[model samples]
Target: MAKAVQKIKLSPSRDIPLNKLVLSQKNVRRIKAGISIEDLAEDIAHREKLLQSLYVLPILDPEGQETGMFEVPAGGRRYRALELLVKQKRLAKTAPVPCIIGDMGTEITAEEDSLAENVHRVALHPLDQFRAFQTLREQGRSEEDIAAIFFVSVNVVKQRLRLAAVSPKLLDVYAEDGMSLEQLMTFSVTGDHARQEQVWENVNKSGYDEPYQIRRVLTESTVNASDKRVRLVGLAAYEAAGGNVLHDLFEEDGGGWLQDVALLERLVAEKLRTEAEEIAAEGWKWIEVGASFPYGHDHGLRRLEGVLVDLTSEEQASLDALQAEYDALQAKFEDADELPDDVDVRFGELEEALAVFENRPDIFKPAEVSGAGVFVSIDSEGRLSVDRGYVRPEDEAPAAAFDVERGTDTSSTEGQEAGASVQRAAISVGGASTEPEEDDEDPARPLPDRLIIELTAHRTLALRNALGENPAIAFQAVLHNLVLTAFYRFTSSGSCLEIGLRTPTFPAQAPGLRESVSAKAVEARHESWKARLPKSENDLWDALTALDGGAQASLFAHCASFAVNAVYEPANRYNQGRVSAHGVRTRLDQANVLARAAGLDMVQAGWRPTVDNYLGRVTKPRILEAVREAKGESSAQLIDHLKKADMAKEAERLLDGSGWLPEPLRLADSSPSSAEPEGEAGPLPEFLAGEEDSANGSDEHPQQLDAAE
Candidate 1:
């Protein structure tokens, strides 16, 4: 057979002119168009400084010929940087850059190799590396191979790959200006050119060139856009129009104009009412018609259609203005406070008048407080009292309460008969005194005790009036009071009535008592329950029952506590079903347990043998002898006998026969006993003690055994 032909390995290298380094538009990756000239200038400056020390440039060949020159495999930036330097007169035009060249067959492999060689070896920016990696990927390279070549995690490679999908404009911007990888990454994820431009404009306007500020604005703006894109766009446009959009939208006006929806509603209703009255006086009914009536029915009355013409021009104008104003106000007040009492009452009066005119009793009632401040009352007895803090006249009847006389039994016939006779007499003699003496001596007529409490009857009215005058002050005061009341009732010892006082001094003293009491109550209940349980139990059953209950409760509480801790604590590594150890030693122990259970020999598995394990107790000589036996040596016994000798002596003897002993070992003396014994039937050589002896000759014969047996 003919001998195999040896292939020649070429150590490839190349040099190319800067002018030939054209960006391959066909192979060029598409990216965002956001790059600016200023950024490009900065990138050129940085790249120039980086490529200044380069020695040679890698060359490429489309064909296998060594003289052929093609596109550069890598160093595109370096070449561009040099060109920029030459243009800027920083370097001579004739200066050569170092590069490695390869042919078409090697182009793909060379590009990959170049990426791997430069990815970590050089200090290029992450984004630059990502771009290079992305270029290779577009050329049909796999992520695994890229990761392996770059010695990076697959996830890292994948993350870098995302840069390829980034807008070409943005990548160009990064290449030219050297923007932060973080900002670029954020912009990549958002993929909103308009928003990105807005962010850029904002940063530039703010004179903030820091990447962090840019990143912060991008992140916050993107998040804001998620829910408020339309509003944000409108606001942006409004701002651009010099309308002070932010202030107009967020700042509160003092007049109730911006505070109450009912005010606007009432204004509209008033105008409508005036028109209605005029129409009524003209012996015609008022009606709402046309496209404005979306329900496809006359809002007022079909018979009132002709009455619409009765409205004077000025009146009609006012009505139209009111309607327009109502629409605008309604839109503004979509989230504004509801109708106030005065507005509600006025609306009710208007609706009632309209209802009377229309012959319909079911006019809309403006919203009202169903339950106002506490209502108190007293009977014929002159007693002073209050309910929910409201004091009422003594003679006024309690609308929500009633009284029953004591000592009136219906179980006995005479009592029942007397009760029936009294009722019949009272009904027959209405307004007539039954018994003057009994009425005078009745103890049920005693005066009731006085009550003190907060009053909420006119709260809404006051708030409305305050809002009308100065909404800012009114809103502030209301919010302050609400906060104070919350603090008082939720954190106070007194009831809501006592906590309603607005005085600063008194409120300050009582503030938080309710909270204190609630906390104490909880603690007290827990302590009391704990105290009620047995201190100790002798019986396992009782103990177990108590433990079961306590443990179950503890487990629930612990789980809840753990959840809370996971949210608030920084060191909570536990997640889902995975258990974590806090210390390295514990983790090692866990690893060891897993290794042992998997039928793996810990020592053989590369685990350091510990004194606590059997492997650690085995002598080196016996191990060596066993190793020799496992190698299928015919003279296993001789190897074991040799191992029994002093390790240093045996090593010295073997090295001496091979004439390779070190000076120290060669200088050492070896007695006959230390050496192999001659014709020994009593005991073999010490080195052979652990090995099996064959039936061949001993050291006395000094004969070699066959290799197989």
Candidate 2:
């Protein structure tokens, strides 16, 4: 042997009287954390014993004589618990508590022993604890019972049980540090073992291992219950039709997701069809049924004038009584901070009764009904949105009578000539004319397209300047547009701007968009305007004119925001000879300039690159490009080794506060130093000032897809 080995001395344990034990000054704990002493004491008393032994030292006198007393060093919580039990008379003062008696020698101080005892012990691994909970469950212990036994919450117990319910292979992967606890939790969202393994296989390859990505790829086919279609077809009815719903216990799922999208769509279609059939009975020539209609579905169509169907005498009497009761209730509670429950319920009942009277169908003339159709679609709130009395161009009545001498004009050439005569007459003043009318702008030919464009362009600029200078007028103009679009079903375009506020039907928007910063800002601004608006239509004029300049400007900006649609529709589709591809590009370029002048920063507007939003949805190269742009190459290199899914996640985190935006959101030609190519410069070069022109094709944005074709 190299040297003689030293032997270690050990401490002995013994039962000490509860009264004989005194609190140790050397014990290091000072802050109260974790379980409270009172609860610990109750737990100890309920079990009739402590789970851990207390560390103690015998009290010695100055003369080296022994005293029948002890001081605790480690396990202070257990000591306090025993003391509390004794004070509560649950334990006799003379009751004995088992403890380890340290060697009385001064070689090792009480403080060192106490610190070592508390610090050296290892806590149980979470996976092990989860498995143990599973074992307890298998042994017939209820979740509540297990929670009581372990001093934890029932939800905590259930969460642990859910983790245990995951496949054993995944648990092994978790135990071996092959996956994170959060990633393991993602597997718990669905119970199919095969799907879990499949997701794991995909996650294990290269870099696609984020928890959210796992959930997305696993449930890509499922439809969220919050989807307007699902909300339209009630969840109860969907489930009654044998549809399955999967819930996320860990996150705010907003009522969870429906697994069968096909079933949901079928149910939605069936409901919509039923509603359409009921509306068809209202004598419309035809009914167009859909979950959503294109933004400009009624474009170029003539809207029929109709009267609101009068309420029956009984309905009118009910409505009057409800209004009276509602007025009385409002007066009674006018000064209250909150309404009483019964009164609130009564008000809701009154509102329902009133709505029955308010939503009466239109009474269109039989002649108009024969030529007009209805657009039946769901609104944003999942309510039935019936757009009535739109007469398509093909359905418009003939302008002039055709003398169809039934057998005399039977030749194909004569039939064609008749159609040509009808077409030519359709353009004239409702009569046969060999010569153009005297009031024609040009009898020789129609105005040149380029000249018309230039004229309209000048008019557009003038209107813009006028609208910008007079905020009050601008507000009224936009309000008029909104009211006409909402109530009249169709409107003649009188304003040069051609304002139309289309309700967005984003079929593939990122989750939680309604709660986004931009969305919230819009909602707040709308509510503020709504509050300031006059209650009576007759007071609207005074109310709007009374507003100060600053208030008027703010309201104007809010209203004008709805008219900003930079979205690109293909000329091949919705242009209908009005807008061209070149026109779309020109409009977008001008819109970008306006946005820059307004200092509109998408980031400031509350758009951020998130996995659910931008990252997870794009291609790997796009994700990497975004990362490389937002962060430098060095930062991008850090995540370059990851797979597509993993890279998107890491990229999202790295770019969180970096103020990064996708190509669709970025302001083209943002910097003054940027150069423009020859011939592609802005037509109004004076407006360029310091801004640069974008390359010929660089001005197009990705969000240019048509809302409707």
Task: Identify the leading candidate in terms of TM-score.
Answer: 2
* Per-residue lDDT over 1-709 for candidate 1, one digit per residue giving the tens place of the 0 to 100 score: 9999999875465444555444332222233333333344355554544432222323345653444334544444455556667778766666544544444454546446445545546567666787799988989889997886555678778767865566666677777765666556555434457776676655554443344345444443111211221122233332343432111111121110111222322332343333333322221111221101111011111110111125568766765665565556556657747876765575555554443334321211111111111111111121211112111233133431232133332234423332332222211101111222223223244211100000010111111222223323323333443565677554322111111222111101111111232223334444554554555445544754766654545423322211100000112355323222233223223223322322322112122211111111234443333333222233234434332222222222232222221111111232111222333323332324333522222221111101010
Q: What is the C-alpha RMSD of each candidate to the true structure, in Å?
A: 37.8, 15.1
TM-score of each: 0.20, 0.58
Best model number under lDDT = 2
| TM-score between candidate 2 and the true structure | 0.58
Question: Which residue runs of candidate 2 sit more than 4 Å off their true CA positions?
Answer: 1-10, 61-63, 197-219, 280-285, 300-302, 312-314, 317-356, 365-373, 388-709
Cα lDDT of model 2 by residue, 212-260, tens digit: 5677667766766777777788999999999998777676667877888
Clashing pairs in 2: 207-643
Local lDDT at 368 for model 1: 10
- List residue ranges in candidate 1 displaced over 4 A: 1-128, 135-145, 178-189, 221-709
Q: How many angstroms is residue 253 displaced in model 2 relative to the true structure, after the best TM-score fit?
A: 2.4
